[model samples]
Target: MFTSRGPTLRELAVQALSSVERGYDLLAPKFDLTPFRTPDRILDETAEALRPLGPFRDGLDVCCGTGAGGRVLRALCRERAVGVDFSAGMLHEARRAHPGAVLVRADARALPFRPVFDLAVSFGAFGHFLPRERPGLFAQVHSALLPGGVFAFPVGAPPHFGTLPYWAMLGFDTVMRVRNRVWRPGFVMYYRTFPLVEVLAELRRTGFDVELTPLEGLGRRPDGTPRCAVVVARRRA
Candidate 1:
């Protein structure tokens, strides 16, 4: 769902026809008005969960579009916070909104930072990384953090079997597959590609000690399982 000020269907269509970087650039101005922006509820919960991990001196937000997640960093990190995104348009909008923080335009796959940050986080951006590319992405984050620093993000519980949301996700991924098959400069986002199990495995392979914290604000399913969780992957000390 989108706001009245958000991208119109025609604008969204043009964005869908572009590469991921270009599409996000086109969406940057109104990204927070769309459901695609990471919800504030999740951001607040993640900030609370990460609070005890602080006196962090410096923080980085990986793939930080419009810098909503950077607020979490500002709350948790005592010293400095920076938001990094490959989309220059997104970085520009984020800089205007969050002038207190630094912004960088760089691909997450090959971050330009040294082991400088005490913590790093990303939100709603994993789908942009193809499954095969996740390892490299995680490795880059690992390398960017100080030895004991963390790389965290939220992940929702998979929709139940036979549910409408499940079928909707299936359809979305199928459409993405078809679009990439027929088009150049692929938009490359898919809902079902990153499962929690496989993601934990990748984090471990990239030398993280991973853990999950239930995001209680998102509630739970009928089976009493969490409907959403914040996956906190700590780089080994």
Candidate 2:
């Protein structure tokens, strides 16, 4: 629906009606072409924002769809980068795009790693997790990292209420709620589920010391606050 190489409307419809994992599997081949993929600009700016915080040895990309976060990890990590996702097809595309990175098929809520990585990053996949599931998810990421390891991801400012973008997000989430009500094996994406205040508290509860840094290159909102910020949660040694 986004470009010539993107999925057709019919393909998107099929994906929307399927289970989340199954839907991503169906969309995997064209995922990078779709608007769902993280933009290159976001990745580049993220790398730029993270450069000062790192001298990272190894990195992990959580819910690493099509390897977007892997690219960020490659730029930051000194040794190697690895990506993990539950969708086999997404991992397949990730592997194809990033031949050097190790791609593992695993659910983010139950990451299969010891305290090995020095840094972990996720991009554009938080909506797949419900608010109720976030604590367990954060705990898993925490367990996967080494002492004092950093977990980072970008969060955008909420669109101003009554604005077109705000309404669009509200409508999309409403439709997803209704869809899930009657659907089997619900697809869990929702735009408004991850509120930053609650998220910071949850991360702290999960044993990470959290900090937020404005991504200045992405520009600022009209109120002079950042349009987007990166949440940097560090595991305590």
- What is candidate 1's CA lDDT for residue 2? 78
TM-score of each: 0.98, 0.98
Cα miss at 56, model 2 (Å)? 0.3
Which residue pairs of candidate 2 clash?
A: none
* Candidate 2 wrong stretches, greater than 4 Å: none
TM-score: model 1 vs. ground truth:
0.98
lDDT at 47, model 2? 88
Write one digit per residue (lDDT tens) for candidate 1, span 33-54: 9999988889998898888877
What TM-score would candidate 2 get against the native? Answer: 0.98
Model 1 RMSD in angstroms? 0.9
**Which 10 consecutive positions of candidate 2 have the poorest summed lDDT?**
94-103
lDDT of model 1, residue 85:
92
